[model samples]
Target chain A: MKTSTLRPLGRRAGDLPVAMVFLLPAAVGFAVFYLWPTLRTMYLSFTEYSLLAPPEWIGVENYQKVFGDRLFWNSLQVTVEYVVINIGIQTVVALGMAVLMHRLTRSGLIRGVLLLPYLVANVVVALIWYTMLDAQLGIVNQALEWIGVDPVAFFGETSTAIPTIALVNVWRHVGYTALLIFAGLQAIPKTFYEAAQTDGASEIRMFWRITLPLLRPALALVLVLTIIGSFQIFDTVAVTTKGGPVNATRVIYYYIYEQAFQRFNFGYAAAVCVALFAILATLALMQLKLLRAGETDLD
Target chain B: MRRTTRLTAVATILSLALAGCGGGDDPAESGGGTAAAPTEISYWLWDSNQLPAYQACADAFHAANPAVTVKISQFGWADYWTGLTTNLVSGTAPDVFTNHLNYYPEFAGKQQIQPLDDFIAADGTRTDVYAPGLADLWVSADGKRYGLPKDFDTIAVFYNKKMLADAGVTEEQMKTLTWNPTDGGTYEDVIARLTVDENGKRGDEEGFDKSKVEVYGLGLDENNGAGVGQQMWSMYALSTGWQFTDKNPWGTSFKYDDPRFQETVAWWRGLIEKGYMPSLAIARSGTSVNDGFGAGRYALSTNGSWMINTYYGYDGVEVGTAPTPIGPSGKRATIYNGLADSIYAGSEHKDQAWQWVKYLASADCQKTVGDKAVVFPAIPEALTVAEQKFAAKGVDISAFTVQIHENTTSLYPITDHASDVSAVMSPAMDAVLSFEAEPSSLTKANEEVNALFQ
Candidate 1:
């Protein structure tokens, strides 16, 4: 009803200098930190550099090796497993909390309680969880023992290590994600829900039909961010697992770190990083497209 | 006029940002060629226990040469390597830093560290002053001296005296414990006898529940010390006459596949199966071996001499150290590794850095450092003083020193691609230790490690 003739907005010549003045710092920062490092990583992927010596260009040799690298494939698979577990659980839990907060209570105190875990540093969260979930000495195990359960090797087993790490990260990130969805929920006009209620629609039906469709953009953002964050998991694995119980939790970033810092194989590490970048970029595009992040049904 | 004012503000902001980028480049602080200009030499080390000792040396050095000042910086072990490597790449590494045998080869190979032979020869610095093999370990494959020996370490067994007494195992029994790959010998027996279950039954008892174990006799660290196993099973393997490689300080191929080594690993793994040792899961459960020992979970922990003070620091635990068990070769062996000081090749004050390095390796510094009783100095006299200081603290260090006195020490496995070798061997060794793979898997791992050299 509020439609108007649409036209592509163009930058005015008069505003260019003002915009540039505002954008200079950010542009400089992006160029120095992000763009330059990305370009350098791409270039280093083709060379054999050990940090100590100058890089030696070797064409596609490093990439070729990466193709046949079993470790790379394993890391990618492990990272995918972590992402699936992390994103699936984190999304559902966050959505539930968001809905609960949106419908029941919108208190800032409750939201702050939800966001508290996210406020803690990743390293601190990891270390505290590592202590709590320890197989022998942790309080979690002691509690489990009291309830007739055998002690679980949370971070030590091949099957449980990545899931344990995923769950730990989920605990840390769920609150922030819930807050994001809660914000989206706030943006959803209450009139739509009120109308649906008057038309004899159940709460679940209205949620499925109206709320989900409207929540696409926020979900898409959460997915893309979390998927990327989950893939680059190094701190938890570094402190807890160190890619062990026989490479069970050797995520891509940890592999890259080991190659670059530990082994001094900077070129190989860079090549792996490029491959990770490609995978993440492709996944992000697919997610955005599938979610239709740009188009909201609000109009 | 308004537009010009806005442009001026923008220019000011841009200039400030650009100025911030250039703040790291301070050539003036790097010192000058002329001795008349006061020179500041930056030194770095990883050990915090040795910080006060080195700081004292810095004070003395400053007193001796008023024009030259030594500034010391300390970082934690893991951060030290990360910072050092990053700084080396960025051409901002300290002028002189403590170097490890694990990294010195790689640094020397890349020519990132300055060869100290020229300075040593020019100053007639006595390389032979250090304990046997300490000074020699710094000589690279190209026969260039890259560092000056500072301190040395050896492996020994730190045991809980209360646990030993409760298990009825005497200190003499611990000292004379012998091990063989075929049966695990007296060492295994002692470990089994010491291991206690939740029901208070020893591992050797008929109904001792392995699943309900309260205390493991032998403690294991996370990995097999990245295949070197310096503080884990290296002594056991070395005592069996199984050298890590054909030659150390530069070995082209590793001999991890050797039957002697494989059997040593197998026998060590058997301790896990028999419940004498904690499984890899419990060991790597984020509780360190020393912490586990202090908590009464581990009766004995094989550790390095560097951790001597740490083991002693555990409260409410009567700690004592014993020599490693003699193996099939009838010799009790320990891996002898020493730390040294090396100058960065890109250092601005090479002359001052060399002078600082010289002073750090001298008797003046070594004696002061040894007097702290924190570590064993490389110099024999300083080491003797350290031993005396340690004795004054009621710590019997003969368990660590007997290897040096008897010449039953093997050098740390120094090879190129040390981390690459670790990458291949750590998982393989972990698999074997974790009971996920067989010891024969190490043969394949050894092949892979050797392939790196090829």
Candidate 2:
């Protein structure tokens, strides 16, 4: 009797159009704003469109030229360097901050203070940091001079421009990464710590074993997100270095922006955009797979 | 299964709520009317500094054409172009707008702005009344005018008087500083003497530490929109017999590979290396060089005629004006940049837009704008009035007008693919200025720039 009653409800009532009616708006919005534009961009990658003029079909030409362009190659190299440096710094800094917050603060005040920088707008933060790091008049250089060190051109020289911009990105995002990691730390039960204590494990040993193993999911999420953000680095570089001192800090996104808006080469810029999307998607998938393998090993 | 359905329902409701809320308020009414009604046209401009003057002109325009009403709107520089481009594609752009030479070439070629030759012929427009080359700058490569010339600009060297005097540099010496392609000539010597170290030593001194500069003798305008680095290097290179291109108005190739340009670039960058000027890092730092001059951090700055008010606005600083230095050709050179008004191709009120642009280029509107001495107008009759107004205000702008009067000005290089050309040239120029590469290294970059045009 229970099977017969449940079957009729599942077969008949489930076929109602109410749910479809409810979901129609969101489906329309998704198609209009996101999905259609993305597909159009991919299509435009195969054409020659100069913003104002109607698109002219030219298959594979933009892609071929973009691959051969020296500036595009430089921008790609700079982007990879930026992503690697950023992820490395973010791992150390975010993990350290999370550990500090988990051990020292109880009321979440410390986490709030740490996450404040992340909440500030990127353009505002860029302007603040740009002023603070001035060679002659900046507060950072002034402090260094007081300590008997020569001034460093953080954003001006080719050797330092990419790293400096990466560090700024690290500074902006590390706080939020730590907050997430702290939540992960909170999820690990206190009983594990007690058990480790009973085993006479040192605090450092307990941290390496119990704390790190439990926090893997959060750390993986943070790493993947930070890598994606670093690869799309645009606003801070636009405001600070303007991809300059000879394109040292010109990341892939800034290059796309210049090609699209400044040079009005919409088709070439679309090809670059598609290329970046492919790279980011591949990277994210690899990271997830590696983490999945790690999870299986732990199981 | 229940969670997914509930989440989908929530998203649906949220999206509907947002979509409904967004259009709750309509865009403010701009006074639309029927086709037979009085013609109402919109005019857009970017400069807040010149808004009041143009507003005065608009009032005069309304008085002259009682049946037409101009609705004026002003936007900040970046917002103006971005918004214009958006409106351009949507076919909702202003009927009349202020156009820039940097953008007008592309706009004309793409037919985003209409040619005014027919309107000019109908009005019997006298282009000869404007400044010598000012009216001609609006003529495209195909010899059709798209804009009516409004005003022009020239560069000059602005100095802090007390700082120069303290460094033992005279006003006469400031005016006479000359440059050569190789040695940097007397111009460099002046910069070195004015540059002081923290240890009270000069840049020319034997032990002066470049790592510890108290003040930079020369201040660079950071992130100049034009890659030519107008105030800093345009005069120096042009005066040394290096042309921007092989031809003018619509040249297909750039001459950045010319050795004269390369040599001048090297000497200019050498200032950063020798501690006579600030590093590219410092120059790119957020503060404007104008502010540095105001704070006594920069002894000298190469500024344009448009910034006279900005120099005078500085507190506790005595501003001094001087002509640009003589160069290898034994002549003083400056860029004679002009501004103009244009009609959008998509406008329904094309005839009304033409009338506004013509009035802006005429002696009537030009004389009113010039008599205020805020800017040098394009009309020649208005030039005298502008100069007298400057003299009356105790601000002598002869440093700027001298270029126009003496006819020693080179036109700003207008050509196809300006933005792409700027992209290649600016970074190469930045490398030279930062002391990372020699100026001759620009040869490769120049080749890349020429490839874009081809």
**Which candidate number maximizes lDDT?**
1
How good is the docking of model 2, by CAPRI class?
acceptable
Model 1 misplaced regions, further than 4 Å: A1-11, B1-36
Task: Name every residue pair that clashes in candidate 1.
Answer: none
The C-alpha TM-scores of every prediction are 0.94, 0.90
lDDT of 1 by residue, A1-299 (tens): 33323422443556779999999999999999999999999999999999988999999999999999999999999999998999899999999999999989969999999999998767667777776676766678879999999888788877889999999999999999999889889889999999999999998998899999998887788778887887888888876789997889889999999999999999999999999899889999998999988888888
* Candidate lDDT (C-alpha), each: 0.87, 0.81
lDDT digits (tens) for residues A205-281 of candidate 2:
98899898778876787778778877888978876787887788888999998888778888999999998889889
Lowest-sum lDDT 10-residue window in model 1 chain A: A1-10
Model 1 iRMS: 12.8
Specify the poorest-scoring 10-residue window by lDDT in model 2 chain B: B24-33
Model 1 lDDT tens row, B1-454: 2233223334533443343333234322332223347988788887878999999999999999998988777666666787788888878888899999999889999999999888888988899999998999999999999999999999999999999999999999999999999898998899999999999999998999998889999988754487899999899999988899888879998998999999999999898888888888877765567766766788999999999997887667789999999989999999999999999998888988999999999988999999999999999898889999999998999999998888899999888888888888888888898888999989899999999999
The clash count for each model shown is 0, 0
